[model samples]
Every structure is written in C-alpha cells, then in structure tokens.
Target: MTITIRSALMKNFLGDSPDWYKWVIISFLLLNPLVFFLVSPFVAGWLLVVQFIFTLAMALKCYPLQPGGLLAIEATLIGMTSPAHIGEEIANNLEVLLLLIFMVAGIYFMKQLLLFLFTKLLLSIRSKMLLSLAFCGAAAFLSAFLDALTVIAVVISVGTGFYAIYYNVVAKQADNNSQIADDSLIDNPEHQQIMEQFRSFLRSLLMHAGIGTALGGVMTMVGEPQNLIIAKNAGWGFVEFFLHMTPVTLPVFVCGLLVCLLVERFRLFDYGTKLPEPVREVLKEFDRKASAKRNRQDKVKLVIQALVGVWLVVALAFHLAEVGLIGLSVIILVTSFCGVTDEHDIGKAFQEALPFTALLTVFFTVVAIIIEQQLFSPVIQFVLQAPPSTQISLFYLFNGLLSSVSDNVFVGTVYINEARAALEQGLISLKQFEMLAVAINTGTNLPSVATPNGQAAFLFLLTSSLAPLLRISYGRMVWMALPYTLVLTLVGLLCVHYALVPVTEWLTQWNWISPPSLNVISSVTAH
Candidate 1:
C-alpha cells in the first residue's frame, strides 16, 4: 500500500510528462537552495536563470509554468528574490500584463473574421513563395501599427482554423471522425504523409509571419513593448521615434524582406513546403460550406469584428490609452455586438491568454532574481566604459546577445536607464545618447528572434495550443528562425557600425530628424 501510494504520487507529479523530466525538475528544486547557501547567491541566481530557460526550452515536453513556477517559489523561499520584489516587477509591467490578458482574448473573439479573410487569401494564392511573402508582409505591416502579440494571435487563429479544417477531413476519410484530437487515429500511410506535408506548410508560413513581426516591430515606437520604453527614456514621440530608427530599421527591414524571398525561393531552412493539394481542397470545401451556412447575423458579426479591428489599429496608432485598456474596450465592443453573452462562451476566450499571463508573472519572478543579484551589472559597466568610437557597436552587440537569452523588455529597460544615467552625469553627449538609444531599440527587437523566450510573441506562440499541434518545439522554432536571425542580426550590426552616424547626420541636415535637445533631456532627467 505504501509503495502504491508513492507510485501514485510520482505519477501525479507533472501529469504524464516523461519520468526523466519530472526527475529533472525535482533535481532543480533540490539544487537551488543548496547552491544558494553553499555558494554565493549571485552564482545561484545565474544557475536559477539557466534552469528557468531550460524549462522554457523544454516547453513541448511540459508547460513551463509548472516547472518554472516551482523554481520561482523555491527562489523566494531561499532568499534569492523576495516576493516583494517579484510583486514590484509585476506592478511595473502591469500594462503589458493587461495587454496579454485582454488584447489576446479580444482577438480571440475575432478569429472568425480572421479565418474568413485568411482562408480566402490562402485559396486564391497558389504560389507558395507569393503566399509566404503575403504572410510576412502583412504581419510586418500589422505589427508596425498594432501589437505583435495581437497580430501573432490572429495568425495563430488562422493556423488553428486551417489545421482543423484539414484535420477533420482527414479524420473523416480515415473513418475515425470521433477521434479528432488524436493524430494517431489516421492509420493510412498516405493520410499521415499528407498531414505531415500540411504541417510543414503551416510551419513555414508561421516562421515567416513570426519574423515579419520582428522586422516591422523595430520600425516604430508602438512596434514592441521595449521600443516604447526606449522611446520614453529618450524623449521621442511617435514620429521622432520612427525617424530615429529609420537608418538601421529601414535597411534591416528591406534586408529582412529580401531574406524572406531568398529563403522561400531557395527552399532554405524548411521554408518551401507547398500546401498539399488535398488539404487545400479540404480547406476550400470547408470554406464553401461555412460561407453557405452563414446567415445575416453571421455577416453582421464579421462586419462588427472588422470594425473593431479598425478601432484596434487606430487606437494603438494614436496611443489612445494604455494598450490593455484599449484591448478591454475591444473585448466589450466585440462581444457585446457579436451576441456572445454566455458566461461559458466568454470564458473560452480567456483560455489562451490566461496561461501565458500566469507564465509571464512567473517570468517576472526570475527577473526579480536578476535584479536582486545584479547579474547583468558587470556587462553594463563594461559597455559603458568602452570608448565612444567602440561603444555604439558594443551596446548593439551586447544588447542583442543578452536579449536573445533574457527578456528584451527587461534588457532594454536596464541598459536604457544606465545610458540615461550616464547622460545625466554629463558622461556622454546628448547626440551620442540618441545614437545609443536607437541602437538599444533595434538591438532588442532584431536579434532576440533567436529564441522563443527572447520575444513575448515567440514565447506566446511557443506556449499556445497551436505549437504542439504543428509540432513546433523550441528547437524547431530556433532552427526555422536561423536564417532570419542571422540576416537580421548581421545586417543590423553592420548598419549600426557604419551607417547610423552618417545617416543621422544627413537626417539632421535635411531636418528629417532633430538633434537631441539639452532642454528636453534636462527636463526628462529631472523627473
């Protein structure tokens, strides 16, 4: 009886994850506190950070929340980071939290509109390369003005919808229609092959669209959460922010599009998988049936969602309110007019974002540990101490490398604050500060695409239901993003190294951008 009880308890831990994984997590929990006491807290803190990232990398084996949360709880108990500091981190990032909670849910209510539009586009575009470009270009454009998370949510919705359409068709053809959730139900080798092909097709498009968000996201203040943080520190308004980034961001953006084309054209890094014809036919039939069944009320709902999407774009463009509040407005407007009043129905919308929100909160605990430990301080000091001629490129390179492993928003916040502090002490010229600010923005946004954890959108997609369905593990995502990551990081580095100074001078010469004003700097620094 004792043995049975112990076995049951072990089985219950992490709920069907691999036994090795459960043991690894158990080991992590046991290791953190011992290291904290026997070793320096700083060393233990870095170890915890690596462990947290390990959990994230193994996200496909189990959700990061359970294992990562356990680590966080252990950290707090061991005095690596206090609950107070964790709360402070969460409080500081409340806006981003709200955006995830509400904006993603708001977009959930509009999935039908997204599916309708994307299905049409999918059906119309026969050329895989052209379709890839459309996905990349549209994602970039949307992410430029709207939130990357929201744009990625839309893409995920479309991917899920398309997958379901083909999945059901395949399941029915296999005479296992009731087992829709199980991929193993399709015993026929041909059906299984088509399914694999379909997954590859979706994977390519998703990679393109994901990279698109990064390409356009670095271009404007509203493109990323960190971009706004950098802009505020530098006293840049929306237009000024856009102009400031144009030197590096514009060239990087063009190069990014070109990379997309070259990869798709050459079929590099799993990019050229064409949508299987049978799956396309299934999607077409599903769309036809869906269209035929659509009533006037359904049409009205689509129209309402379209209008709300417009509002989402405009509100975000104008900085109408905190993004979360705007997202809440979208939720109220979308659900109320769309006739989705049931409590259960509305609750389904929260399913996608809530888990991610919880994971993000847990992520803040790790960030708190970093803060309490000052793990990044030495690197910041090294960069700051470098000569002015070498400082810009170092800042860009270090920021990119750090952001690839850590949260870009946190990395940007820390570096930008240090830069602002230097300026306040009159250590660097205002012009040099401006250059550093742009480098920080581009650095954080561009190369962080190397890992799922580097960008919130990538992390969100990694944890979404869609990733598992598409077989997009962390390693697969990294592999697929390699070309874009290399191109974006290398191009961004060169532009920062060579083009930024001359381009900024020209922009200033033509009055396209203003030199940093001492008065503005002083006033901002005063607060």
Candidate 2:
C-alpha cells in the first residue's frame, strides 16, 4: 500500500519532496491542552477532530514513520484512525458537567438576591448576627455545591461584592460611599506594574471556589456533571444518583460551610489588610447593600426556597419521564418561567445563557458520538482490562489529577463509562464499580480548586471576582485543600467500599449494615 502511494505520489509530482518535519510539529501541537479545557467547551468534538487530522496527516500524508520500527510503533498508537472518538467522548462528559454548573450559576444568583431580601426583612429584628451569617452561609453553601464560580460571577465587590456586576462600577460606588484617606495607588504605577500579580490573585480565589464546588458536587448529582456521567454510565439515572450522592453531600455541606466561612472569616489575606482602605470600605458598604438587597428579595427567595425543596423531585421527573438534556433544560425554563414569583426581581436568567447554553448542548452531542465510536478505545481498553482494583484506583487518581486541568465531571464520567463497560462485559464486577465510583467521584473535587481551567473555576477568576479579592494560589490551594481532600477521600472510600464490597462474614455478624458507623468513617486511612 505504501509503495503504491509513493509511486502515485512520484507520478503526481512534488510528493517526493513533502516536508516531513511538518508532520512532527503537527503531532506536538495537536496535543495541546486547549482541547480538554478550551475548545471542548465551545465546539465539542472540534478537539478530537484536531487530534485525528494531525495523526493522519503525520502518519499517512506525511509518511514520517518507517514501515516497522519504534517510530512505526509510536505512529500506530498515536495514529488513532478509528471512527470512534476519545476527544468527543471526553467532551460530552464535560457537557453534562457544564449543565450542573449552569444550575449552580443560576442558583448562586438566586441565593444572592434572596439573601439580600432576607437581610432586608430582618431590619426590624436580629439582622445583624443572624442575617449576616445566614446570607454568608447561603452563599458559601451554594459555592460549595455548584462551584464557587457561580457565586463569583454575580458578586463584583471583589471579595465582598463577589456576587455583583461591573466591578469597576461597584468600585466607583464604593468610592462614592466610603470615606477613604485617598490612597495614591489609584493614580500610581507601582501597584499596577504586575498584571500577572493581579491575575494570580484572582486565580487563587478561583482555586478555593473550584475546590468548593468539586467537593460540593459530591453532595448531589446537581452539584456537577461527573455524577450524571457516573449515573448514565451505570444506567441507573436520578434515584441511583441521589442515593449515592445525598449522604456524601450532606456531610460535605457541613465541611464546606466551615471551610468557606472560616477561610473568608479569618481574612488569612494580610490580616484583612491586603485590600486597600478604599476596597475595604467598599466591601463593608456592599455588605450593607447586600443586607438591604436581601430585604427586597422576597420573590426570589420564594422561588429558590421552592427550588431547593423540589430540586430532587423535579430532577427525577426528567428520568421517570425519560427526557434528555434538552427536555430537562426546557423543564427548568418552563417551570422557572411559570413560577415567575419575582418576574421583577432576578432579571432574565437565560438571556446571556443561550450562547453558552447552545455551546454546551451541541458539545455533548459530539461527545456522545466519540464515546460511541471509541476513538480512544485503545487506551480505554487498557484501563478497563486492568485488574479491577488497579482500574478503580487509577480511575480515582486520574480523576483527581486531570480535574486540575480539565473538568472532573467529564473526566470522571468517562472513567465511569469505561468501568461500567468492563463490569457489564464481565471484565469487572458491579461491586468493584460501586467502590470505584465513590472513591473517584469523591476525589474529583480536588481539581476544581487546583486550577482555573474548570468552568466554575474559570468564572471565579473573572477580574471582578474573588480571585483578585482573595489572591488565592495553586500552591496555597493544595495546602488549604489537603485536609479536606484526605478527610473526604477516606470517608468516601470506606462508604463506597462498604457499598461495593461484600461485608466480611465476621463483620456482618455485628449487624454492621448501618452505613458504616461514624467511628468507621473517622477511622478510614487517609493514605
């Protein structure tokens, strides 16, 4: 086949002088992280298409490799010509994860407005302590559950206005309200020299929020996409998902509340002096506004209150009714529209959402196709064929790692599908999968905080969000998150192990089926 192609090329002219180096460069460039984190979010299988085209161009068109050698071997592995699609598959998982994030963002906005109303209502009562804690707690909890990026988008007072808009506008508002001694930095060049410093600060804040969401996601399927991916892969849908996640979410919510509050409360950032006097004054003023904002938020509060109450029930209806993503989104739109408790309040929820929203839905379509085709079949095959324990361990480990640069929800679901396929084909067992899902899913939260690549994390990094306000960091996040990760993972691993692994006969004799006693959770090995 090669000889014939070469002969034809020679006859056709110029083929004998093809630039082989171009192929090598193509291979390297196509491997860029842009696919996993960037293009996939917007165009779905576009990244996979890049991979395949590069592989083919390098191998066949460029003919850079010999007939049979090390280069040939590498080419074979790299030359993924399958109609199957690893890139799209990965992307699809990301889409589902994005959906959950949508809910997170939607809910975050709801929370802010509602909290504002609540605080306002408390004006005649104990609005000081209780109202403040209540609003902050509500914000933190949502941040943990849906990815803090959701909260950051609407909060523009730097850290204080972490839920506002036009941060510059808020800054001007603060300038007007606060009685600052007028720092010269607003007119000085020294403070403005390092744009990177500003960016890094934002990145740090996002990292914390990312960690929060990833951890929070474990609490419920709506927390993020990985849960849905796992459920879909298992063919168990909503009931199964809620069953697996709710118990974990409730405990994590407590953990999340403390972490978010303590971190913000302690003002670990420069004893709360990192921000300028003007900035500080602005934040305090906004808190007052936020308090005032909550007072008028009655309609929003009612809608969200009902949303929390009916979230699980409404989600399950999608499954019982056998509707897909479009159907589910429609349900959300319709219900939200019909229930327009505060038509005058929350603004148009899905207005700016449609473009990003379309991007999400179509992107998943591409992902579904890739999974169907198995462009990544070779690697996936290796992972699935490994010993069940090894596969499970790798799944969770990779889940944690990739989530740093990519969406964990997408990565985890892909792992879930691979694990499920293995189990159904008798390559592994359901019991093994159950444990694997818990370990991997629970660990998925770490990546959310480690990097700004995540959808939730990225939004959190907006110049106006907490990233600049808090000055978070990659290194700092690891330290901040280690305790949470170790605690959550250990508890999660054991819960999953109990669920997936058969109880030893001796243990069963003790009537130990009560969801692993609290002592049992605490005793699990962090390592």
Best by TM-score: 1
Q: Tens digits of per-residue lDDT for model 1 on 227-344? A: 8667767777667788889989999988888988898899888889999988878878877887899999999999999999899888876678877788789889999999989999
- Give each model a TM-score: 0.85, 0.55
Q: Locate the minimum summed-lDDT window of 10 residues in model 2.
A: 63-72
For model 1, the run of ten residues with the poorest summed lDDT: 172-181
List lDDT for all candidates, in order: 0.83, 0.45
What is the overall TM-score of model 2 with all chains considered together?
A: 0.55
Model 1, TM vs. native: 0.85
- List candidate 2 segments past 4 Å from native: 1-149, 152-210, 237-239, 246-348, 351-391, 462-466, 469-527
lDDT of 2 by residue, 1-527 (tens): 45787566544542443545444444544543444345442232335534433332233243222211222223224432222443445453554545543454355344434444433432323322233334445444554334344554533333343322224433343434232222332443543333234334334344344454455446555455556665455444454444555444456556644554454456442211122333335445656775565543555555655565355346543454432343345335534643554654434554434444443343343345445545445665776777765665556566666665555544565566655555556666555556566656765764344444333444334333243344554445455555445555555444433433443223335643223222222222210
